[model samples]
Target: MKLCTLVNKDCSKAAVLFNSKKRILEYISELAHQQLPDVSKHVILDALMTREKLGSTGIGKGIAIPHGRLQGIEQILAMVLVSEQPIAFEAIDKQPVDIFVAFIVPEGNNEEHLKTLAAIAEKLQDKSFCKQLRHAKTDQELYAVIQGDDNG
Candidate 1:
């Protein structure tokens, strides 16, 4: 599925608001809970933190895609956050990450989860896309950029 299909306008947040990984993860968990009421925020945060233990998800060029899976969730939920200032994420490229696209999927849905991950990673790798996202000044602009149909 496309990133646009997973994240809508409501899931987009201002870059100036999120300045740390903690706030970013909290925002993602809250977004997930909106979709899956029974999903525990602590559970999602735990899973994400465990994944981070493996390594930072930052893929460079001002992007980070943090993901995790859990048993309680029935489907996948996503959140897109942009930071006005890049935050230290210990990215593989050794660059701070400013854009975060987080995903939480069901434990057994590995195939779909990976598919979504691949889509997100591949798309964000484009330099032009990163520039577009950086230029986005509002939630509407960011949502359009994430949707890959920016008219402004």
Candidate 2:
């Protein structure tokens, strides 16, 4: 249930230009499509959007964890995106968000989903870790920061 284990270099991006939450979700859907070609990007977007509709995933402090549960997925899919600038996300704290960690999980495994989300949330809660993420210059650096590589 580690965030680093859930996210890989290819699935992660740094300093992306996402002006809106919709664009961020679309990018995440594309990433998911790349990993799971059989699953439609539209379906992926729908799942993520549905959760957003219930409430903003924006956990404040410039972070958002947009997640969804879907059938036909054997394992969890995660993608990370750091925006070039903060974007309005309607966060509960009423602050803008820049860091996005999106997840697509198997619909039946609620326990796994919660544990994975908790792990991700815990990691992001670290101010120093988030500072490293925001300072990452490239995808590799971003992935490294997620992996806690200080030199990255």
Q: Tell me the TM-score of each prediction against the true structure.
A: 0.88, 0.95
| Candidate of highest lDDT | 2
Residue pairs in collision within model 2: none
lDDT of 1 at 2: 77
Off by over 4 Å in 2: 149-152
Model 2, 1-152: lDDT tens digits are 67777787888899999788898889899889899899999999999999999999999999999998889989999988999899999998999999998999999998888988887888888888888889998999998887774322
Give one digit per residue, the lDDT tens place, for model 1 in 3-76.
77788787787665666777777777777777677877788788888888899998877788988888966767
Cα lDDT of candidate 2 equals 0.88
